[model samples]
Target: MRYEAHLRARALERPQHAALVCAGQRISYAALADIAERFASALVAGAGFGNGERCVLFLDNRAETAAGLFGTLRAGGMFSVINPTTKADKLAYVLNNCEASVLVTQASLLPVARAAAAQAPSVRHVVVVDAAGELAGHEVPWDEFIAAPSILDPASRGIDIDLAMLVYTSGSTGEPKGVMMTHKNIEHAATSITTYLRMSPDDVVLSVLPLAFDYGLYQLLMCVKLGATLVLEKSFAFPQKILPLLESERITGFPLVPTMAALIVQLRNFRPEWAASVKFLTNTAAALPPAHIARLRELFPQARVYSMYGMTESKRCTWLPPEELDRRPDSVGIAIPFTEAWVAGEDGKPLPPGAVGELVVRGGHVMQGYWRNPEATDKALKPGRYPWEKVLHTGDLFRMDADGFLYFVGRKDDIIKSRGEKVSPKEVENVLYALPGVREAAVVGVPDPVLGRALKAILAVEDGASIAPRDVIAHCAARLEDFMVPRLIEFRDALPKTNTGKIRRAALQAEAEGRELPGEDA
Candidate 1:
């Protein structure tokens, strides 16, 4: 079923139930549904948005953003959420690539939105939210658009197989590519995930991850799907502010990424009461270091910590069950409920347990393909066991244990060969995290005539914690094999991160290559 239908159903069955709490606004199921329908009227009447057209939402975590999501589908059109921090050039590239019919954004972001929409000829309307009375001639105030009489005639709505949303993720080529997910694909994935999480209407979920990130967006969608209350926030940059919401909202489910968790673990004077109401904690975007996960358990003693692995191509691939967390902290766990995944060798056959190979996933959650890019799609979606099926070939390398638990090695291209021996950066980085002073770490291969490519350790140490190159090298040498240890090490105040807070490894690799290698030998 379409995501919009879930909101409508909740509105009809439990109109008075609280559906959303954001920015001092407590919106009920009935109110949220009305907002969605009215926004649909705005899209259809104001922009002439037609069936299957694209609407790009350049917004933050707000009530209108949620309304816009469901409204686009209600109008039988697909929607895309662009990261609010995206610059004009990149945003324009996405707008043109998707040929977006409407651009929905907030007043503060109007500068970049206005510039990008000006370049995208396909954008017919620029709908501005959170604006004052005055508006640019080309801009349509959100209040005016949604407040107008309901001019939308619900003659048609999207079916199960129609595209529901386009999630634009960073492409391997540095440009962005939109991952198209259908209503059926999303429904199945959402159902399977919520079943595994055991979420219900009584649950109150809180999230600060961006709407542009699929994981964050699902928190909003899944909560609505189950008739639950969602307490949405814009950022976790200041945990002091975010921490209070857990207790204030009586949050049951808390979803976070590794970076957020890192900050939480380091925060001083964390009150036991802050986590008293949290029933579970879900983590992805990257596996939490086993050491960090242990600390998180200490912090949220009552909360079940779930470590998961996924990509934009497929919503989620595997989740380490809370029951099995201590036993298998290193593994990303089995494939998420109902999905079948295996490690495939170069010959396109399943590899035996304990052998590393590319990960292959077969499920409804696998994205149909990249939008308008068949070349990349062909490389990712290949023949499945069934002739009619196209399974997603996740380019990441992994190994499954005898019990069918998967261990992420690294991305196919992320593996570094040094001293004529292959090295997984994740493995080295995991050990680095165990160090007392280290907060964040990324390992990359640097040019070396002797070792072929030397493993270099780049780290972000904790504040006021003194860490030296020798200290890092010595720690790794104690735990890692000779070739697996780094040959050089560097320290930075903070490692570069994506908008989602993932360490920008590719950016580091490129920067490392341009500069001359350091050391007397060089």
Candidate 2:
């Protein structure tokens, strides 16, 4: 079940089916499979990058990015996909930390790629897509890469648990950390999702998520395994242009986050018929507030809406069923196929249902470890679980109900303390978002004289909508209790977000404390 195995299977089973669509270009399964193989050959023989080397892919959501990923795997080398928005300093840290030997990037990103490479002496070559330029010491034109004649080495028969990819995460502490994933780990995740989602060759998926994220990477693997059609959209900025394509192409499956979900429901003149062509609407990355969930149901009443939960440490842990929307609307649902999870107490002992504790998962989808950080690896993984012995201890806290449904609380670090009462920041943020005229809101704990930490709120209002800071605080007073309501409010045009699209509360707290000034946009 390696990546190429899925590619080969799809090529034989559904060669004529569209394997990738972007802009106006469409590629069949056979064509994609063939290009990946050629790209792999070029890496090994033409460029002398073989087994054990790591190649960093710095590109956006494009067909060539997918090609570079599978091609690296096919060449018996581990790969890491970088975020397109990563700047010089952070990008240099990841390259140097992983000791990447090669970099594969699109033409537009080559300048940044070369700058990052300059800081890491381990990098031997640069592979550029559609651009030719000498990068001081190393450069190769990616335009002629696949067309070049290069010998393909024998496929790796190594243990399936061998390293295949180094997926870097936004390090909350400082620098980003790379999470090592095996071929088996990737395959198991893809298989588990495809089975439960009931994906088939008939499913046509239009993906807007980036390939660097685990959630987005799984879409590619699932499509290959199920022999389904995949349309790789760059972004979800223009719903007007994208919605028609969804109907015209009859796209049946889509994975979106709450941000995109909010925008989709806001589309003018949106009809059920436009989205009726899609059979499944999946969500992840962050928890969808109950209010947003209700709105999604109203928009796509006929489509099955799946609320899933997972992290980079493990691909996906659980999924709430569309049928259980009414009964357990708040729960994240049972463990995904071949995965096992449980709540653990403060002492690290397992807890039974209804106990609020850390959620730990054990499965094939669990990553091997952080690329080179043994300390962080030891903290995250443990022994004695299912699928694999290595267990992934997710830092977020959750509680399970009698029927095995998981309800997410705030992150362990995100909890606020007021008069000895532990309050969830997410709870306050959710209420703030529900207020009229508010477009986005973030809650955080700030220094206080009487209490150890006081509740603080940051709000972003929609254009032309008016609301005073006191009015916003008063709105929270009506919904939340005296201690739970935020004592201070700050208004801004936008909230700071992580690369993966979660609100950056730490940054807001820093801004509140005057330790740092807000960004120009703010």
Candidate 3:
């Protein structure tokens, strides 16, 4: 069954149950179901999109955004959620690449959406959810469309293989490619996570991540599937306001990135009561520093802190359980049910325990392929026969322990090379973060004339802490060899981050030219 069916089942089971809570708004399961059905009907009756069609959802974290996502699923169409902060060029790329027929966005975004849609002729309809307005040459005022009666169209039936959401990811080059996730893929991801986490029906999840990111999107779906409550937020920039919400709403599940976790653990007067009722605290998007892990464990002693590893290619591969967290603090944990992780060396041979190699995943949760990009898809879905099943080649590096626990090293592309020697940026970043007064650190390889490539570290200092580049370099020198030490270091107010809260190494590399990187011990 599709995610929408799960919502309907929940509505039927408990009509009055709170399904979605965004800011001050509360939507019951029944009300949310009806709105989704009505919105789906509007697309079928008003818009000219049908089964297997795609719609672009370009709104922030609001009630309408959630409705539009589920509505597309129910209408037998794929929903592509565009990042609200997506610039015009990227937006144009996704709309044209996906051949989106309809775009559901807030009124404030109509002007930008219309501008981007102008470049993509396939987009025929633009529906605005907020302040009503008319675009020069498009259908606007989304409310007018949804007011139409719900249609019981036979085509609305969604099966397991039907596409539910088409999430696009940035390619190695320009123009992001779409990742098609069917209902079964999404359901399996949600069910497996909910089952592993042991989420209860009374759990309330505080969603501070963007729905455009699949990891964040699944939090909402899992909540609906398990009859839990979702408290949505656009961002976590304001921890002061968010801390109270977690307490007031009695949030049981909270997921965050390493950057956000660092901030929350260091907040002034941060108390256990801030997350007193929270049962689970999840970390993804980026690996958490071992120091930060200890701090979080101290703060949320009652909560089960989970460290999960995944990418857009496969919804999820492995999740480190809270039980093993203290013992194997560095491990990414065991693979989820129905999933297998085999670390292969450069020669494509499976590596034994304690040997690091490329991490590959085989499971139903893997994406079908990159949308309309056969070459890229073929590269990622490297054909591997495993008992009548295919596996996905995740470009991540990992290692397995003696007990079959997996530990993440770094991305294949993220590894820095200097003088024909490879260095893991995560290791350098972790060493920097271990130093007192260091808040966050990102390591990148920069061009060098002598060594061929040089290492650089960007440091973000903790509030009110005095730490210089020399101090950081000295700390790394004590822990690492001369080659592993960053040759150059620069202090930043904040590091550049992706929408999912991961440090963007590509962006950091682009900005590292001519600035005299910190470490050069040659």
Once fitted onto the true fold, the runs of candidate 1 whose alpha carbons sit more than 4 angstroms away are 151-156, 414-522
Q: Which of 1 and 2 is ahead in lDDT?
A: 1
lDDT per residue for candidate 3 within 1-522, as digits (tens), equals 677888888989988989999968899999888888888888887786688899999988888888888888888899998777665656888899999999888877776777788899999888887755345557667677788779666444668798888887655553467898888888878878888898988999999877887778888889889888999998888998888888889999998876578788688789678879988898875557778888888888888999888887788889998889879887788888777778988655689999989988888898888888998888778766545655788887888988999987655665554532346677677778889988878888776533435788888888999987788888887655455678788888998677778777666765664443343212
Winner of 1 and 3 under lDDT: 1
TM-scores of all predicted structures: 0.81, 0.79, 0.80
Which candidate has the top score in TM-score?
1
Candidate 1 lDDT for residue 220: 89
- On lDDT, the candidate that comes out on top is 1
Candidate 3 structure lDDT: 0.80
* Top-down lDDT ranking: 1, 3, 2
Q: On residues 1-522, what C-alpha lDDT tens digit does candidate 2 reach at each position?
A: 456677877888888889998768898988887888888888887778867788899988888888788888888888898867666555778889988888888778777777788898888888888785554547777767778653675555255777989987644343456888898988888888888888888999988877877777778888887888888887778887777777888989988876577787666688667677788888875556667778777877667889888777788899988899778877888889998888888666778888899898878899988988998788888766344477788887999998889987645555554433345677677778889899988887776433436778888899999998888888877655455678878888898887777778877766655677355322
RMSD of each: 10.6, 10.7, 10.6
Clashes of each: 0, 0, 7
**Cα-based lDDT at residue 337, candidate 2:** 94
lDDT per residue as tens, model 1, 1-522: 676889989999999998999999999999999989999988887778889999999999999999999999999999999878777877899999999999999999898898999899998888899887677776888888899666666544768899999997655454567899999888878888898898999999998888887888989888988999999999888899989889989999999877688788888889889899998999875667777898889989999999888877888899888999888887888888889999999867899999999999989899999999999899899999889999999888999999999998756666565532346677688889999989999988876433436789999999899988988888887665455679789988899787778887777776766754232210
Between candidates 2 and 3, the one scoring higher on TM-score is 3
Ranking by TM-score: 1, 3, 2
